[model samples]
Target: MSTSQTEGLLQQLLQEATVVARLSGQAIISFAWLWPIRGVLYTLLHPHVILSVSRTLFTSLLTSAIIFTVLAFFTYLPQAAFLSIFTGPLGPILALLLVGAESVFLVTFFARALFLEPALSQVFDTTLVSRGQNSLVRDGKTKYASSTKKEGIEGALVRPFQALSRDGLMKYLLSLPLNFVPVIGTVAFLFINGQRGGPGWHTRYFQLKGWDSARRKRFIESRKAEYTAFGMATMLFTFIPLVGLVFSFTNTVGAALWAADIEARENLIESPRANAPNSPKTNEGDVRAKAE
Candidate 1:
């Protein structure tokens, strides 16, 4: 392309990188409260919330470990050769490939456990209380009615696999070529993966809210910008070497915080009184009339 076009592309790439960095930084800051030990403790303490999902978590970890080990073993010779010759680009490419292999499953798996289920349970329980309903019973004799139909653990367990299917698989494949593009490619990968991964964490919330597949698609599409930011931050976190595992859990907590913020905003907007601060109040009028 022409000089101006090249310069514009460079600028665009810089801007995208900046956005990813900012979002990643914000994610770290937002989730700083739940880092390391705190996040693990939170998950462990909430047995009622996390026990059902524990099997999926263990399966994901075991599968990812096996896949990562196999990939590392198979790629060792090629990776060593590449490192000896062209250590710059090929080095990162190999790392990305290996990590991506496991991350395809692990990231979604952790997101579901750390963010979706817990957040849905918390949000739904709060919603029930707001509606004058109880999720639990104080008396041993009576059980509380279910607020929402449970979709089953199998569906949640299979989500990462669904993400690896035709449509979902294509986005990841398309992002691979970008890894060769130097600095720009890395940023592009972050943006692309973040965009793809953002909505997966929200899957549990959608299911819990009783949104069917079509409605979930529509709602996610409508909030594309918000989820893109979320996904970008998550993608950046996954790019970190060792800490990414810990951050996976934190990402879930961050996702819940994000969902709670969204619900709070929606509730504020939906409240009639919140929208009409100056409107006359019947209680005030009645008290004045009684005094007069």
Candidate 2:
């Protein structure tokens, strides 16, 4: 993809990431399955390469610390007897691996927020409204119907049914087979669910703008190819070492920015251009446009 297109994808991914991060805070407090599952779903929804890197680092540290404490408790006795099973001399290695896997999961979670949910939200707009409005409302929306405010723990369990329905369940079940497929399979499964809740938010955003589901879906789907390409491009960043880590934060933002670009272009929404004021701009057209 061209630099502009790539940047656009990143923008979109980042915007979704903010939503993903907020939703994740809710998911973490709610269900056992929500964290990693939510993580993957968030990734699909957001998929900002650079931001994912920073988020991966921040979350990996936090998650690994939690994982290590839990594993340490279990592995301590076994290792003491020299019959160590899960965490012997291999503890550090395992910890590292777990953290790495977690980083990937975090990425997947964001992506889910970026892709799956918004599309489904468009499909299930009616259901989002029909599911009885709870007493609790999110910061922006008036009622449960207008916001992606999934009711806390109680709502989490029932919410899927109201929003997703049988067809969504079928699709989720069909995706279950992918979980068995070694490393990639696990990643795929994470990616699929990560897509949830997000599109609904997008739907709400569109509703605010007097847009409908079909219009929103058409706009997003048009950029699907670009989104995939953005993922592939960011895949390159993971290969680099220390510098990659530095870039990872920006890369994720870049991913979100890319998404924003798609939204802006398709919807005729105007976000601040990258070349705004002090920001560097090599794009001749952007610079010329700004100069004019």
User: Which candidate comes out best when scored by lDDT?
Assistant: 1
Candidate 1 — what's its lDDT?
0.49
Off by over 4 Å in 1: 1-52, 80-98, 101-154, 157-163, 211-218, 236-250, 274-292
For candidate 2, the lDDT comes to 0.36
Kindly report which residue pairs in candidate 1 clash with one another.
Answer: 194-231
My TM-score estimates for the predictions, one after another, are 0.54, 0.30
Tens-place lDDT per residue, model 1, 71-178, is 556654665455435456466565554355345544554455454444334433432232222212111012212322333234232131233344455445545555
Candidate 2: tens digits of C-alpha lDDT, residues 1-292: 4677556645654464454444443433433222223323434564442232344455534543454455446643443344224335644443333333333333333433344233333222222222211111122134434444453311121121121343444344444444334445534433343444223223333443444458877865653333333332333332232232222333333433333333335323332544368655444433332232
Lowest-sum lDDT 10-residue window in model 2: 128-137
- Report the C-alpha displacement of residue 85, candidate 2, in angstroms: 16
For residue 107, model 2's alpha carbon misses the true position, in angstroms, by 12
